[model samples]
Target: MTEGVPATAGSTRSTSEKTAIFWLLAGVLIPLMNIVGRYRVRGLENVPEAGPFVVAPNHYSNVDPIVIGIGLWKSGRMPRYFAKASLFRIPIVGAILRKAEQIPVERSGNPRDGAGPLRQAQQIAAAGHAVVIYPEGSLTRDPDGWPMRGKYGAVRTALDAGIPLIPAASWGAHLIMPQSTNRLSLFPRKSVDIVFGEPVDLSEFANRPRDSRVLAEATLKLMTAITALVEGLRNEAAPTQRWNPTEHGQTEIGRFNDKR
Candidate 1:
């Protein structure tokens, strides 16, 4: 395997343990990312230098995963995403994702079927890997770009694995590729700000039954932390109430509107 960037101070893994495909992708993508956007990363010290942890971030754009991936990479931890299973069926992309060991998430209406990915993610976290899960599940439907209601996967995974759950926020990626549009603006060189917040305190929920009420409360606490981080980056206050797709009769996944 090719030697990658030096591991962060407390990380147990060495640079040489990175997969060849990961390095290859990083070699190409990192430079491209720099050219596309100026990154401003902060609060990396909040990340546990070593151990399995789940980082949940607010999602608002199609390019979020790429930007957040780079941010975590700079923080000295290789990010393993819970990517949509559909992407794992693509030609070359799927092959690379598999080789990179990214987890695949299958979206389904059946609760049993949907639990599979979370179980796999918990196992991965237990084995001491950094897992990045977007608690929102999909891009935010909030009109002002604030985070909407979040799902329970991130909290469940962290609580089950008994690992710290870190809340993260990324701002300005939507300027590169605005929501509801396929166009890209590489000229102005937007500054993408990413901030990692301290691990959410789940002690109150620890050892409690993972019932719907408990999970919902824990998920809200996690999302609240993420929104606060985002508020700091934007220098604006989020709405008192989070946006809910169900209340608005909008689909949870995919593009709901074409307003760019």
Candidate 2:
């Protein structure tokens, strides 16, 4: 565990695991995010006063995590990401992530073999920290940019750890670093917004057997909350039906254009 700065006055609980590395990274990235875009946030009060909670945001650009982290920093909680293990293998970036105590997620291999990451996520929340997760696992391929079907890991971690699930959504980050390529556009600043919705009520799923049906229901609830926030940011209604990438034959791992 790493510790950095205390939580804001609104939080009864101070952030204990925010490390100096976290602060350094935030000090650099938050301004960078602002340099590339306007950082507009809302509903920070919706974040629990003190405890472990999950920040489930839709993935759209490579910059999403950085933007989300900036928002959480303003809200008084240091944000931790469930980054892919391969990313932790990078020389400098990996070392920084390790120092910051980010959790590494294994996205490949057998489904049953993925328990270690989820277990680690549970442990983090159980320790009173927030983990930023992209519920769709990667950037959305939903033609119109609405949240797509999500994996159940976020809900599972929250339920198992008895923490609240905070649905976060972002829109303008995609414009800063477009989803179609590994490129950056910083000349004309974009407007990026990340909103945190009220904790999703998973009371019904509490203490119940985590069957597939229950997990599916819980996943949809998170997606719904995130979609609502996204719509509010984008000022457009989400498609009534959530997009399923596999059904639509879009690759879940790489760049996918809606018009493609």
Candidate 3:
């Protein structure tokens, strides 16, 4: 634990709100996470002690959600994610997700359907829970693991809900679960570092019309803050230009060859 971090044990939600499955999963996952990787968390004071807030972190691996979720949990905030709708179709997994009240995101191409997930996220955040939205939408296609161009979903949500948009960064989780494969290397435990930064300043766009240009700029600002935290954790300089899948002829979603 770092200085200035909150000492609260559970999330912002009351004990009665947490479901049995949520606790069961927490019990099994938290201990296992500790066993697999040594974590050093910082900037806990940035997380709000109460009320709704948005956590936007860089996405690089399938394990990121778990790692970030644990980070939020340790910071005394219940983390809710916008998960894929298909995940809700799995047998036991779907049941558990539903019981835990995780929001399902339907990625239908229809622009009309797009608003549904964001609406759900807004509702969740309004209820005083932390909503974790990966601005990159999927794992970074950047060969160096730097965060690529981000989507506007995270920025839009925070702006619509009028909540704090906190930029967070996590480094070294890829060592435990690389983007290339699903294997877990637990023998030699890796060091995973997660840092939370101050809430992004979106006041300029608060009253502006939510046009594409404005939203894109806000997303870039959010991504820039997240990248800075990642740089501090890794002690390395990111590329001058952020990665863009479209420019590189890569699909926005799903796994693709990282090699250029």
Model 1 vs. true fold: TM: 0.91
Please give, for residues 105-134, the per-residue lDDT of candidate 3 as tens digits: 776545576688899888887777788999
lDDT of all predictions, in order shown?
A: 0.82, 0.79, 0.83
Candidate 2 stretches with Cα past 4 Å from truth are 1-12, 15-17, 254-260
Residue clash pairs of candidate 2: 2-17, 3-18, 4-18
Candidate 2 C-alpha lDDT tens digits along 1-260: 00121222232366455578877887787777778888888988887667677889988888788888888888888877888788899999999988876888766645775588888777766667788778898888886678999988888887777667889888888888887777878879888888988788888788689998999998998899999999999898989899888787676763455544
Candidate 3, TM-score vs. the true structure?
A: 0.91
What is the Cα-based lDDT of residue 255 in candidate 2?
Answer: 46
- Counted clashes in each candidate structure: 0, 3, 0
Question: What are the models' TM-scores?
Answer: 0.91, 0.90, 0.91
Shift in Å, residue 90, candidate 3: 0.7
Flag regions of model 1 displaced more than 4 Å: 1-11, 258-260
